[model samples]
Target: MLLSDARSIGRVALPLYLSMVAVSLGALVNTAALGRYGTEALAAFAVTTAVYFPATAAVAGAVRGVMPFVAAKADDPPELLRVVRNGTWLAVFVGVPAALAVAGAGVIARAGGVPAATVAQLGPFPLLMAAAMLVGGFGSTATSCLVGLGRSKVVMRAGLAGAASTAVLSPLLVWKLGLNGAGIALCTANLVSCLITVSGLRGRLPGRLGRTIHFGQIRELAKVGIPMAGTVLVKFAVLGVLTVAAARVSTTAVAAHNIATGLAGLTFTAAVAIGQAVVPLVSTRTEGVRRAVIAGLTITVATLAAICAVIVLGGAERLFTDDPEVRAAVAGLLALLVVVVLADGLQAVLGFGLAGLKRTTPSFVIFSGCYGVLAVIAVPAAQHGLTGLWAALAAANLAVAVGQGLAFRRASNL
Candidate 1:
């Protein structure tokens, strides 16, 4: 029964999984490119992205509130257009401030005690990321809308295009312009993604799309999106703190931390894709939701384990960098990184399952409380280097994973 149900869910999840993994692989390549550029360049990339990713995620999550509504209204073209319009407006309302904030995050990097030299080399990376944020908001909304309408393959195709751009651009640009070139490469890649997804979305809508802002629908999108955004924001905010803490340790520490977590993100996205694909399926069958979540957890664990095993056996850590110190530092933290990735993957599926049920409030409450604890302990944990810091992070994820599992069971009676 579970195997049958897993195959059913995989139909929707496979495309999402492929798309996200492709994007992450592009990022991994970007990381490798910047790593070769030198430790200072790598540190600059870490500092800026620490700020960029979370802020953009919050905006994207906020905009995605329209997806379920879009799905519900899919057969009704008029209402679907309205949802799309409001979702677009929400994208702008949230995207603009985020861009401005990211543009100024060099200050935050300084305040966070990143070395003056690393902070000095930031250049136009922040500005480029700011532009990416604007495009990202729309890309996220368009992708979500397409997924809601069962056009996930369109999203996948768009992602592959972006990934291809990143692979080609990161090396060429970074080699010429330093890490700032990385910024341009990343921005262009996101632009490519945005254009494609928006184009796909355009084909799906039949009538003339108006540029009118509907406050009522914006409020509805916010009602669901904000709490969901809050959940994503707090989680990223905590990681941002860790980035700062790693910076305090050494450039090598921060860079190694980034590589480890970046790889973990590759695995975490598998669960993220499953959780997303399961959302529309969630309302239809309670038992099916349970089966999907279980299948998702199993897949997430196996994927991470396999990736980690390959990294260990193949001595492929060299693929990320030539810095022996950085490689050694990451090597010591591998077990903890595995724990953190597993816990995060498990909780993500459960938390997203609750979100699918339109029960996002508890997730916000649970993450806030648990991660709040991690925030408190971050400084002390960093005193022990990456090992201690990751241990604390792993503990927090486990607590949140347990909390989310209980919540999912209570909400769905699964």
Candidate 2:
């Protein structure tokens, strides 16, 4: 049964994994390109990304909460169509506020105590990314619906298209326009991806187009999604706070932190692919929770272990930047990521498993409480320097992973 479950998950996860890798590569390329401009530009990009990702996560997470519901009715074409329609509405509902929040990036950066010079260099970068978020939210909804319907290949293709566009356009824009060029490239790529994914959905699931927004369905989605959104928001908010603390330290620390984070994101996406694979299987199969969780953990452990080995053996620091100081700093942070990535992988699988069961509130509560405590500890730790900050983050991931693992055990038993 375990082997069978693993195979099933692998089938779904492989394309998703490749797609995520492509997207992560695009981010890595962006970071590398931005690094050429200067440390100030890199730091500004990091700060803006820290702010932008959380807001987008909140909106995306809420819309993704529709997946389990959609999967449960996968055999019913009409019902699935209705769920997709309502989920689109939910995307718009959450995305507007998130876009507004992102538009105020300059104010937020200042309040976070980012250096004035870095802030000045940021320009219209934040506003452009905010627009991307609005379009990306719809893309996320369509992608989640396809995942729920076991059509992950469509999502994979869309992600690849976006990544390719970003990879080609970001450097050109940055070379021509500086920091703002990166933003323009991101917005254009997001719009293109959203159109592709949504169009694919229209082709695959043609149906009546005149249904009005159903508050009952919206409420149903929110009942599950709001907690999921809260979970995602809490996790990213912790990182945002840490980014602010890093800014307080020095531009060098911020640059090192972003580089390490970009590397860690590659491993994190592998975990996400496994979790996403588990979601539909858990929703559709009876008595599948235990096997699904085990498969997810197994794949996550293997994937991250391989990544850690490469980083340790290959001296992968040169892939991002050439600065001796930044490379040295990244080395220490990478050591911490060896543990953090495993813990993060475990928590992602467990949290998504709980969501598949429609038991998302526990994840929200556990992550919020664990990360809140980490936030309090991180402020003083940042004063000590970058190593201290990395240690604090590592501890936070461990705590959340343990908490969510235990919660999953209890939820599965129920």
Name the top TM-score candidate. 2
TM-score of each: 0.85, 0.88
* Whole-model lDDT per candidate: 0.84, 0.85
lDDT of 2 by residue, 1-414 (tens): 888888887888888888878877787778878889678878888878877888877887898788898889778887877888899999989998899888888788899788898788778888898899899899989988888877788888988998999999989988898788888888988888889888887877758635688889998888778898998878777887888888889998998888777778777888888888888877776686888889888988998899889986798878878999998888878778888888999999988898888888999898999899888887799998889998898888999999998988998888
Native-to-model Cα distance after best TM-score fit, residue 321 in candidate 1, in Å: 5.4
Instruction: Please identify model 1 stretches exceeding 4 Å from their true place.
Output: 28-47, 106-125, 173-181, 243-258, 284-288, 311-318, 321-332, 382-388
Model 1: per-residue Cα lDDT over 31-98, one tens digit each: 99999988889989988988888898898788767666776778889998988988888888989998
Among residues 3 or more apart in sequence or in different chains, the pairs in candidate 2 whose N, CA or C atoms overlap within 3 Å are none
